[model samples]
Target: MILLQVQNVERLFGSDVLFERVNLDVQENSRIALVGRNGVGKSTLIKMIVGLQSPDNGQITKNKNMTIGYLAQDNGLNSSNSIYAEMLTVFNDLKKMEIKMHELENEIATFDHLTQSQTKYDTLLSSYDQLTHNFKEANGYGYESEIRAVLHGFRFYEEDFSTIIGTLSGGQKTRLALAKLLLEKNDLLILDEPTNHLDIETLSWLEGYLQSYSGALLIISHDRYFLDKISKEVYELTSSGTDHYQGNYSFYIQEKAKRFQQKMKQYEKQQEEIEKLEDFVARNIVRASTTKRAQSRRKQLEKINRLERPTDGQQEPHFQFTAERQSGNIVLSVANAFIGHDDKPISGPINIDLRKHQMMAIVGSNGIGKSTLLKSILNKIPLISGEYSFGTNVDTGYYDQELKNLHANKTVLNELWDDHPTTPEKDIRSILGSFLFSGDDVKKVVHNLSGGEKARLLLTKLAFNHDNFLIFDEPTNHLDIDSKEVLEEALLNYNGTVLFISHDRYFINKVATSVLEISKNGSQLYLGDYDYYVDKKEEQLLLAQEENKQTGEIVSKQPEKNSYQLTKEQQRQERKLRREVEDIENQLEQLNAKEEEIQNQMTLPEVYSNLQKSTELQESLKKTQDKISDLEDSWEEKSMELEKFD
Candidate 1:
């Protein structure tokens, strides 16, 4: 089914047309990425689709009963309710149904002995059965599990469930909003820059989830790696209008390049033809023998249709970093460093060395204190423990992920000009223009700038700072795809040492010569890029699991009494213990599921209306939960014993 269709859509801003003749259809399972540079009307088009804005021409049709969920760049999920409580709101219907089931159960218990009461009970029971079936179909039993899975995927810990939504930081709030929207299960999900707050792990998980999502998806993101993984189709909105591609980001890149080559060739060919005709006309017009031919040639020239050249083929921001002086061989050293707040240190015992000109990427789950570590190194924040020092002559510049260094009240022109007090105004303006802030754009207040604009402004400052070493936190957070690529190139070509924290896997792969994995266990070095780290981690995990399985099997055999082997009776007992552990784990899972089912049934009208039955079922559910808890404990103990085999 086509969930949405837009035809002949045209949007205008005053006299200027933003886009025209825009057309597309979203099927029930469509996965589309709407992409372009920053100001190409992508957001406006998305707004039009969501009914937040209206098109000046044509129509957009949404299927009847279609539900759409839109996650803007910043979802702004601000609420006083706790995170878990907010999530439960998505299943309010299920909650109400569960209440109905319990009420029916309570009523059915009132009269059960007499023949008339039996008929009444049966009717109530029938209703209860139907309600229960609906509850099950709606996944009342699994909704909490779904909530937990999404929360975990978004990197929210169990402890965060009870935290008030308003207490969360901006990124956390955005993530929470995304989590709620996912659970809403709309017919179509449209996200604008959904990758913003996501770390690499969360990003990978989201990609996997969205790939299997039942609803159609239309996402606007600049994360190439993310786009490559999630989008099956691409819609690029250039200033010229919307262009469609039938593949992922990589395919889009390849196909786009091919088209560019094709257009360039055609344009060159047409230009040559025009030149030849013009030359013939110029020479022949002066000669009386060919005056008629010249007139014919001139007419042909006038009739010729010319193709407008493609606009600079998507201009990338010009980025370059020049180190004023070289640093020592060992650019940075850290010893047993613990970083975080003064009261609560987040990660510890970190030791790492960064050599001169080495682009080292610090990567890990979000909130693992990557930014905190950078701040500690920069002396903006005190290290909770251990020591870190930069080598001799290492002048450092920092790009704060939050752009806290920027003076919000200052104009863009003043921001850069203030940094370099003596520089000529013309030179500063030229520099700003190179970063894409042209003419009156530089007069915009820093605080009013978009995230991408702020990022560009920061880069403009970093460019002229002439620092020998640079530390950046989430540098690619708000940059568009083209800007990211340019920044990647600039870092790759940079002569200075770089230590940066970024969740962008593509950016990490492009810029990093080495990678550091930061976790609660501290820093571990990877000699290569993101892919290498992932491959090595997967190999280690497989090796560990394989070792555990092999150890379990090897020790399971019965044998005569010996130092290395158990007696037959002892072997039997050991085998029994292992089997008991496995049985308990399985029982825990079954019991949990059963507990949830009973709990969901209790909420039906018939069940809850009958006080006796509702009470009995509640008792049963409590018993099941207790059994599950006991089995879980036993499973853990036995699993630990089995682990001793390895």
Candidate 2:
């Protein structure tokens, strides 16, 4: 069923048209992604759909019975209730039913011993039974468990369930809002930039959760990987119109390119035919012998419908990072480094050896001090302990996510030209032009520039410096997908070494050659992308679980059964349970071995060097790990069951 339909929807801001002729449908359980550049009015469209705003033209129709849940970007829950209590609001109806069931039980018990009329007694009994049935059907019994599961998925634990909403951080509150929305289970969920504050682990969990979600999703996100995982269809919104792609982000990229090429071919073919007709008319129209033929050609030309030249949607910034000079093999080395503020360490005894030409990414959970570490390395903050050294002849450039390096009072052109006063004005303007700052745009004050414009200005400075090494703190924070791709390409082609901090898993996977994970315990290095890091982490966890089993450290928590003789039937049941548990353990052991085999294959030089082979092995490894996980879960359950026979 179509829960919502947007037909030729158009919106305008004064005389300027934001977008026109927009069309889309949200059917039951559909996963739709609305995507475009920064100012293409995606949020405005969402508002119009949700009835927060009205369209200037066309119409939006929504099913009267359907419920819509909208979570705007960074829109946190505002409440005085505890986290668990707030989640319970979604189940108020179930709670009422449960209370009625309890009341019915009490009343029905009264009739158990009373000399009541038969019809009245039967009626009370039936009412009790109905209430009980309704409560059970609504999951009143397991609602708390469901809440716990969702809270855990969002990284909220049992202890944090009682935490006051007002006391939580903004990010935490936003996550809680999303969790609450999920529990509501509305017919349609409209989320805007929902991936903003999530780390890679949380993002992965969210992807899995939404994959099995029962409701439709209309999502706006800049996370390409998230879109690819969640969106079954993508709607590319532009100023002129919206284009629908019947696939994920990757497929959209491929298909969109193919379509643009096809359109170009068609347009060119029509232009050629028009040119021939015009030439025939021009050459013969003045000739007396061919006047009638020329008149017919003119009619054909007049009736032809011309094709507009095709264009790529938006202009993406160009980026190229060139090294000024060669640096030593070891670009940077840090050991026993404690990075944080005012002599208080957030995470440390960090150690890293960044080699030349390696793009190493720093990743950690929120507030774990990834950016602090970057600042410490750059000497913007004093390190509490240890030291870091730069390689010989290394010059560094930095991109601050906060844009703090830019002077607010300076104009865009002056921002770059002032740093290099010796350069000609036109030459400086040319560089700014490459970054999409031209003419009057170059005169905009630094403080007045949008986030993306500031990011480009910073990159422009970085490129101009021709630094041999670069340190970036969340450089992709303000960039659109197209600009991010450009930056990735620049970094991939650059001769300089890079050390950066990012929460963008897709960007990390594309540009990072090494991943340095920061944690409370310490720092660890993984020799691959984000996916490889995840694979390695899971493999280690499985190995640890296996070792614990072998060491007899996973003993049942239950006390031994009271000493007593068992009947023959009881003995048979005990035997069956033990056999199943033993079978699960054996299967787990085999899977563990297979997982190790795949890991060993992944380490082979030839396999690691080949992207396709490496990807295949990773996929195989993931499948094996998933099986082991399932077997482990089964093993735990069966072992607990066998404990009853102990």
Candidate 3:
């Protein structure tokens, strides 16, 4: 069933066209991700779909009975209410129903005095019973518990429930809004950047909850891993219009590339045809010996239609950061680092060694001191205990999501100009243009900038600073896909130490060499990239699943046995199996080579007539193919055995 349909939607802000002739159909139970570069009308489109804004042209048709819940970027939550009271607003209808049902019950009990009143009361009693049944079916009785569980999953503690919304930070308010959306149980849920302020564990919990949710979900987020884990379809909003890709984020990227390649080939072919037509007209026109032929050529030229070049092709930016000097071997050393806020320590006794040119990612649940750790490292916040030291020749540049360093009253150009006074005016303008602030946009006050523009300005400043070390707190928060890639490339080529906090797995996988996980107990170091962390975690999960299956018991904690704990004989067997798999893979490669050789030889038709040589090649191919099949079977068996240890 189609829950909503948008047709020929045209949205405009004054002279600028946000999107034109856009069409989209949202289906029931569909998990759609709206993605695009920043300032490309993704949020505007969301607002139009939810009826918060009307399109200049076209229509949005939603089912009359459908309940739509929208979580705005700012949340718009009242600051005076407590977190619990704010979430309880979702159950207002249920509360009203309960009140009506009680009123009807009292009326029915008093109706015995009059005959007409008794009849009316009987009818009302039947309606009351139906309403009561629905209220119960909606889980109104356990609604508070359900709300509590959702809040907890989002990293909200029991004590936080009574905290005033105004007392909570921006990130807390965003999470509170998300919790309200979850508790509302609307038929359609629209969330904008829901994962922005969440940490890894909270994000993982959200992914699980959304996967199990029955309602349709439409989200706009930059977290590729979250989209890949949750979204069934992706809708890309470009300057041209909306493009649909039927798959997860990774699959969408691959398919989009393939489509672009295909279009490029067709475009080249069309250009060739157009050139040939032009040549024919130029050569034949005005020739006296062939005046009639010239006329014909002219007519054909006039009738020819030129193909428009595809605008879907985008040129990725080239990013390079030139460092003044490399840092010492020990870029940063933390001795018993204690991180906290308001004299309350969240985590302590943390020791760390950050080496030169190393990219480290700090990850943990929300409010679990990930940002506190970064702040302590940057000396932006005072540590309650312990000490940290930076190596010689290390100069640090910080990118905080809150944009605390920016002066609100200054213009964009002035912001950059004030910091780097030696920079030429033309160079400053060019830098601003690269970040998509052009012409009069540079004159806009910093205070008037959106979240995305502020982020871009911060990046522009960072690029110009050319520091030797970088401390980023959710640097990718307001960046679009293109900007994120540009930042990733810059970091990849940077010859400096980096310690950043991010929930974007794709960015971490591309740039981070190690991960630091902060917990209430302490901080644990994982000596690997994002993919390695995922592989290790998945292996642990699978092993736990296997143990539970065998023993019919649940194990909530990780078992204290490593693969190295295997007996000598078992270890020997494992190593032998691994070697056998490697040998089989080598044999398969050889067989593939031989097959390619035979194909190359058989390209000539004359080779087919050489029956003896052909038969010999065919026999050799068959034997190699059989060997490849046997090897594959052996490899599969060995792989299964290896998985047991994992």
Best by lDDT: 2
* Candidate 2 segments exceeding 4 Å error: 112-114, 555-646
**Which TM-score value belongs to model 3?**
0.75
- Please rank every candidate by TM-score, starting with the best: 2, 1, 3
Tell me the TM-score of model 2.
0.84
Q: Mark the regions of model 1 whose C-alpha exceeds 4 Å error after superposition.
A: 78-81, 99-131, 157-159, 163-168, 312-315, 407-414, 417-425, 442-448, 550-646
CA RMSD for every model?
18.4, 11.8, 9.6
Candidate 1 residue 71 Cα shift, in angstroms, is 1.7
RMSD of model 3 against the true structure: 9.6
Cα lDDT of all candidates, in order?
0.84, 0.87, 0.81
Q: What is the TM-score of each candidate against the true structure?
A: 0.79, 0.84, 0.75
Q: Model 3 — which ten-residue stretch has the worst lDDT? A: 558-567
lDDT string for model 1 (388-409, tens) is 9889999999999999999999
Query: What is the alpha-carbon lDDT for the whole of candidate 1?
Result: 0.84
lDDT of 2 at 446: 95
lDDT of 2 by residue, 1-646 (tens): 9999999989888999989999999999999999998899999999999999999998999999999999999999999999999999999999888888878777877765456788887888888888778888878898988888788778887678898999998999899999999999899999999998898767876886786688999999989888877887889999987999777677678768988999999999999999999999999999999989999999998998888899965787886999989999989999999888887889889999999999999998888988888888889898889999998989999989899999999999999998999999999998888888888999899999998899999999999999999999999888988899899999999999999998888899999999999987669999999878866766665566567779979633212221122432444455456546655655665577679989999999999999999999999999999999998888898778767755
Task: Name the regions of candidate 3 deviating beyond 4 angstroms.
Answer: 13-16, 79-137, 140-144, 160-170, 289-294, 312-318, 341-344, 408-411, 417-423, 438-445, 534-646
Q: Please name the candidate that would achieve the greatest TM-score relative to the true structure.
A: 2
